[model samples]
Each structure stands twice: as C-alpha cells, then as structure tokens.
Target: MKVKSATPVDIFSLTDQGDALAVRLQMLMPGASRHHRPKPFIEIAQSSFRSGHRCIFICSTGIVIRALAPVLRDKYRDPAVIVIDQSGNYVIPLLSGHEGGAVAFAHDIAQAISAQCVVTSAMDYSRPIYTIGMGCERGCPLAFLQPLFEQVCREMDAAVTDSAVTDSAVTYSGLASIDLKADEAGLLELSKSLNLELHLFSAIELRQVEHLLSEKSEIVFKEVGCYGVAEAAALCCATKLTGMPAELALPKQKNARATIAVARSYAP
Candidate 1:
C-alpha cells in the first residue's frame, strides 16, 4: 500500500486547560489547527472530517462521541478520533486505530505531554519504521535493483530478530531519494514492485542529514550538492517518520548502476 503522509489535524478545545493542550499540539504537529470554543462543535468536527482532517477532541469522550455519532463512517474512511483530558492525564484513541494511525499519533502526543497513552488497538505497540533510499543511473533496469532490496531486507530482518528489540516483524515504510530522481524509471518501478510510497527530498533536505550518514562522498556532493543520496535520503526519511534523527541500520551498498541504504526509526 502507498502509506499516506500525516494528515492535517484539527484540535478542538473549549476550556483554558484544553486550549493550553491545543497550543502544545500545534507545536508538536505541523499544520495542526486549533479551534477554541467554536459555537457549534459538531459542525466544526464534521467539516474537518469531510475535508479529510483528523479530529482531536480535548474534552469528555461522551460529549465528543455524541457529537461525532452522526458523522461516524467506516474505519478506513473516517478520520482518526482522539480524546484527551483537560489536565492531559489520559490520552485515548477512540477510532480508526491502525487505518488512521490514531494509536501511534496518540502515543507520540502523550509522550510529548508526559501523559498516559491509552491505546486499545490489537497491535498497539510502535515498531521501527524502516526506509530504503536508492540512487541509480537513468534507465537502470528493475531486474538489476530488485534482488538488492530482497537481500537487504533479509539481512536486516535477521539482525532485528536477533536483537533485544521486540520480536515483532520489521517492514519497509517507504522509499526515498533526491528530488532529481522523483521521476526516475527504475526508482518508480522499484517502488511499485514493493508497494511502498516514494518520497523525494530536495538537495537542501538531503544535505541537512549528511552528518547522520555512515559514509559521505565528495564526488556525490560535487554532483548533487549533497554528500550521498542513498544514505542522506534514508536518514532524512527516517527523521521525518520519527520526530528524532534516525540511525543507519545498513550503510550504502552499491552495484554498477545503483546504490542503496537503509535506516530505521527508534520508538519515541
């Protein structure tokens, strides 16, 4: 599946405490909108839902539930719903646990606020979100690059299974590269084959992550204004997924036509 980017969040608050929490959320989540004491709470939530925004109610569950009852839709179609107390003591994911990432989002927010996260999803634990970054010559064949991904995943899976981190399986969240390769044929085909989203970052974004890479290349810097595409993209994507800088699980490995790197997130 093409995992979508984080959704725009709409936080509704009516009291001083709730408004304070909303301010914190604005800082924590980019593009998060705060609505303080809207006249009709239900209408505001419905509008946000219809517009594909995640709805977070910093009020009593009963009140939000009653207001959202009429707007409730299928889990896949409905926006994520989270409820938090005014004092920020408890954080609850009320709807769309996995499909909407309410559980994960709640955990991140709870951790930021030092509140207790109450996740009810069956598989509630957060795992590392691994990302693969690749750089290849124009028109490189998928046949040449496909086997490399399989090999990398096999090696990383073995390493993760042997580690003390949770025994749960590891999976690639997406593929990333420098913006120049946004339309590269081989990269697009590789992403399609793996059923993962492809994110392209600007040279500046990639350069910002150069310090985190296991290896840096002067040749690559002269060519693309960055030290390394594969390692830089992997580290950059990992940081985007998690709110912290990521560690390189596997440094850049290359064939005659392509280079690949892998990075994984640490749980917040």
Candidate 2:
C-alpha cells in the first residue's frame, strides 16, 4: 500500500541525511513546510512556541536536539516533539515519547516511508498501551464533554472519581453545573465538569475497550476514532491526579489547545 500522507502542523529544518528519506517524509506530509538545513528551525520553534503550537517536529542532529530541547521545554507548554533523521530512516521520539505520541507518529511515518522508527518508552514498551486525554486548554465544551463522559456512567453504573487539582480552574463560556455522576479527582470545584475516568491501559487493552464499546455500540465515538483531544483530557487528568508522568498524552494539533495542564502538586 502507498504511504498515507501525513502533514506536520509545524516542521522545522531537516539535515536531509539523504534525499531519499527527505522525499519520503514530503510524501507522507505533503503540507509540511520544508527547508534545506536547520536555519529556519530555531525561528520556527520560537514563533510556534509563542503562537501556541503544542506539537513540533525537530529533525536534526544531537547538537540541534540539545539546543532545541530547553528551547521547547521553556517556551512551549511542552509540545509533543519528534526528532527524525534527515533520511527519515531512523526516528527518535525524544520527550513525551509515549504519552505525547512521538513514538506513534514516528512509527506511522516509518511505516509510510518504509523506514525505521525507534520508540521505546518504558510504560509503552512494557504494557503496549495508549492513553487518550479529553479536553481543550481549560476543558472541552460542555456539549461534547457532557455526552462522552455521561455515557461512561450510564453503562458502568458506579465509578470512583476524584479531583487531583483542588479548585482547579475549569473555565466555561456559559453557566453550567457540576452534575457529574462520578466523584471529582480532587473536589467539586468546577461547576461545569466532565464524567471522565483515567486508567493506565495497554494499547492492546485500549483496542479491546474500543472493540467492546464498538460491539455494544455504547460509545458514540466510533466515527470519531479512539484518540482525540477529549480522550487526551481524560488521560491528562488521570495521570496528573495519580502522580504519573503522562503530560504528553495529547499533541497540540491546534493552538491554545496548545495549553498544558500542570499537576496540582507541581503547579503554584
């Protein structure tokens, strides 16, 4: 089968380890802007950070990677970053390798380009699971949040919920009530909240859940796919509350969605 064309929202300079790999990547993501070297890399990084791009692709050498790491960490809300060889032959998912989806992106790209994507996150490697968070910056709109999470309660009947971030600011454009069926991760702070749950599930396990949910036709998200920003919010809340390292669960495919959720323990 031909490689599926995937475009990076923001693509930085690439070494062109060789024309073959570079060309393959172009084919994968036809819309991604290209450059000869890493010159525009820094410029794009800076602009994309302030503009709220949560995911960035840095294709360069170890030196560039070192320089770009802190730049991304400091400026952006810890975007989902991917570092692939110029040849697109060897790919490395530096930060948020697992949760952020760097590994998945690399793997998918490698498959399309017929290259090698090296993804070895301890959690993913051991359990082979994929976690999805559900939310925007503060959270997703009540319209979507209400239905998606409510379904979980309708079927499960009883589920334990808590708010890890006590009084965590959950901003909403309209007036809403915290009529959740489950417990909050920390406390009932946000009047408008979601009926969400977090769990450390193996990708294999998630597939099962998706399949089971699909068979039963309980989840309306069959057409929405298993992974989305809403799923990212669930994963983010679950991991953040449980004191697990999983901030990279969602990619900043869009802006202010560029926002990051800091663990209450770590937040000021």
Candidate 3:
C-alpha cells in the first residue's frame, strides 16, 4: 500500500524536547508546519485558529487554552485543537472534540506515536466503537473464526483496561475484510452470529493506509496485492464507518486457520 497525501497542520512546541517530538511528528504527518516558541505565541495561535488550521500544541494545557481563548468560537466553527505533553506520552483533545473532529484526530496522532489518547468528552463515554478485521483460508469454518474473534475482542478489552476511559460496554460495530473474502462462508456466518454488518474494501483502498501497519507481510502481498489484510481492512472499515481516520486498537493476531485485528474510531 502507498501513503496518502499529507493534511495541513500547525504544530507549536515550547521546550527542546517538545520541539524534537514536534519534528518527529512533522515527519509522520507530512503536512505539519512547526512553530518553536514563537515570540508572541497567542497571536500565532489566533492566526492559525482564524485560518481554520488544525493545531497541535506540545505544551501544558493551560498555555494552549490561554492562547486560543480569544479566538474561541462555538464548536461547530472552531478548528480542532489538540494538546500533547512535551514527552508525547499523551494526546488530548482540548477543544471542538466532536464538531471539529479533534477526538478522532487525537486518536490518530496517539496511535502514530504510540501515545495514549486522553479524551474526556462526555460523548466518548457512551459506548466505544470498534471494527474487527479478519482474513482466513478459503474454507475456514465458523467454528474456527468465532473463537478467534472472541479472543481478539478479549485482547482489545485487556489493552484498554488501564486507559483513562474504560467502557465495559464497548460496541463491536462491524466486520471488515478484503473483497476476496466477501464470499467466504465463515465470515458470513460470523457476521450473522454477531449481527454486525460486513464491510469489504478493495486492495487499492487498503493500500492507502499501508504505512500505518505495525507488521507487513511479503507473502500476504504476493497473494493479496496488499501488505496486510486484517489490520488494513479493520482500519479501512473503521475509517469508513466513522467518516474519520482510525487507529489500530490491536495489531494482527493469528491462529492456525485465520488472522484477526481490531481498529477503533470516535465518531463525530
């Protein structure tokens, strides 16, 4: 899979460590333009906000709040505001969480840097959304796929157990897979059993997010024309469902007959 074109971003950093992390993020998010301790920080922030650029501030939450306060408008009109600590340990959606798409944006940044997203919006508490991606041999049976799906869901639950928000009632919104698997009986059965819609993506669509995969397989590419099936499909499906980019909640896990992965998105 090939990378997508970069999206525009404005990144502000306070300290040397923050600047360094900013540089790394700039590389990851190719559209980012960095500002390292500008003389009048508030003015620059206001400019960015007025211009409607998504902003990321690698400083204390207070600094960002103060700088953007004057330009703050209603959530429907405000640009996304994200705050990250100097160490890049946490990514928080400080403003316009739902209307401005900051919650989903924060999740994407956090996943790219392996940071934890600290989303405190009340909307997030209402059932978390997840999509499961799977790939299996031609004749794989539901008996084999069902247990693997359960195991991966358990894995997802365990992974988020220590996070800031732990929703025990997380919703498995759908199942995703390559178009080749659309006719697979096991997948059809699993979709029926779970009462979840099945989403299938072409290999070309899956390739767009190939850069985000944690693990890629040459063998899989040789067979499917994409580096991975489970992870790419899960991410593609989640992005489609939420109308926002998604992050892998769990990387690809495999058993004898099938492979599974999970992706998450916060709907705006």
Candidate 4:
C-alpha cells in the first residue's frame, strides 16, 4: 500500500540551530507549524497532544519526555512523536511507535534530511529491514548511480507480490559498502540523495558472509580482498543492523561503472 501524506505536525525547537532544522523539516511536512523556544513548554506540549497533532521535537529526548509525561495517554490514543537532534544526525521515534505511525514517520523524515532513523520500538523488531550494498568505480558520477538505484528500486517494487507487503515495507533503511569505499564520491552522493546512512564494513567483515554470496569474483577479491562487494556488503550491513543473519533480497545487479545488491533481515 502507498504511504499516506504526513498529518499536521508541531515542531518544537529550543535553540537557533534546532529552530533552523525545525524550519527545514516544516517545509517538507505539510501543515506543519514551528514553535521556537515555546514558553510554558509543558502546557504547549499538552495542547498539541490534545489536538492530535504529530509532534517533532528538535531537542533533547529527556526534555521531550518530561514535558509530555503528564499528557501522555496510551500508544493507541497518543499522537506520533519524533525526536530529532539539532545536528540532524538522528531521527528517533520517541512515542506511539507503531499504532500512531511514529516509526514510519521517522523513516520518512530521516530520508528527507539525510539522517539516520534510530528505531528502537519492540513492534518494529518484527518488521523486515532492507539495506543496499554498492560497489562503484572510483570517482563514479552521481549521474550514473542515481538511475541505476532507481531502476533497482522499481524492480523491487514490481517483485513484491505478497498482499501483506506494502510499498513502505520495502523502503531501504541504509546503504552499505566495503570500508575502502567510504570516501567514494558517487556512493556518498547516492547515500545523501537517499537520506540514509552509508555503513562501511571492512573486507574481513564482508568475508564473514562469503558463504552466502550468490556469485563470487576473484578479480574483486584481488582488488578488495573480498569475493564480492555488492552482495556481501548488503548482507553484512543488514546482519549488523538486525543482529540476525540476512538473505539476499536482490542479488547483484550491475551496470558499467557500478554494482548494487539488496539484503533483507529481521530484528530478533
């Protein structure tokens, strides 16, 4: 199923940087209003809660928790709440994770701003997580990488025939590659475009998943010390994310300058 547009959002910020970030987020969220350094914060929070508005707090998680403590009802009745740090490095689903759609909203916000969604909800543990693994020629241009990435995503969308799986279910949670590619411009740009963290694994780390690779390449091994870059990195990252073994969701797909693969895993 297609994800719905976000509901009205109330963004709370305590500092100038947080306010700026809040404003940036506001532009992306329809019907979002900004509340910079809101006085009587608890009262404002309670009012926002009563209105059933989705809330984004660009401040300390502690402050948000304290302010909202008195007003919280239950997960089913509370509105979705997200906490984003001033630096925008992380987006967290702070309350009403599943029933209120905070987890999914966190992912959407993270993707919009190139931040990582740090989802810790127990209900989220049962969902599948996808990671994209990539290998590209040094200095490969974003022009080459973006289209291939989109094509792969489209293929994944077409392949999801299960009635229970929605389009949102296949949203990629992160990108992965050998540590050697950590500075690769194209890979970095693609990760920025997707607004997902690019997790780098060492060759030794990638080797741990060699047995699961769908194809092996001696040429790649000679260069990167791993049998495969795309597939192995994908699986390795997914495993790391979920603390469980990962399977190849899409085996390596390559064009002239880049190779990409997808891996899937479940959190225990």
The best candidate by TM-score is 3
> Evaluated with lDDT, which candidate comes out highest?
4
Ranking under lDDT, best-scoring first? 4, 3, 1, 2
TM-score of each: 0.53, 0.44, 0.58, 0.53
lDDT comparing candidate 2 with the true structure: 0.38
Model 4 lDDT per residue over 1-268, tens place: 2222324679999999999998788776546789998888889987997777888999999998898898888875677899999999999999977556577667767767888999985556457788999999989998888988898898777555322234443689889999998889988988998999999999999998785576789999999999999998998888888886566777899999999998877675
Flag the better candidate by TM-score, 2 or 4: 4
Local accuracy of candidate 2 as per-residue lDDT tens digits, 1-268: 2322122345554444544455555554546544445555566565654443323354555644665655564311344566666655676766655434455555555665566767666543321212333333234443444454334333222211111112222321111111231243221222334322333333332332221110222232343233332333433344444444333322222223221211111111
Q: Candidates 1 and 3: which is better by lDDT?
A: 3
Query: Between 3 and 4, whose lDDT is larger?
Result: 4
* lDDT, model 3: 0.80
- Name the regions of candidate 4 deviating beyond 4 angstroms: 1-125, 162-169
For candidate 2, the TM-score is 0.44
Cα lDDT of model 1 by residue, 1-268, tens digit: 0111245679999899899988887776667789999978788888887776778889999988888888787775666788999999999999876555577667667766778989875665456678999988878889878988888887776655544343545688879999999888888998998898898999999987664565678888888889999988887887788775465667788888889989766456
Regions of candidate 2 where Cα sits further than 4 Å from its true position: 1-8, 14-20, 38-40, 49-59, 74-76, 125-233, 236-268
lDDT of each: 0.77, 0.38, 0.80, 0.81
Question: For model 3, what is the error of residue 235's alpha carbon versus the real structure, in angstroms, after optimal superposition?
Answer: 0.7
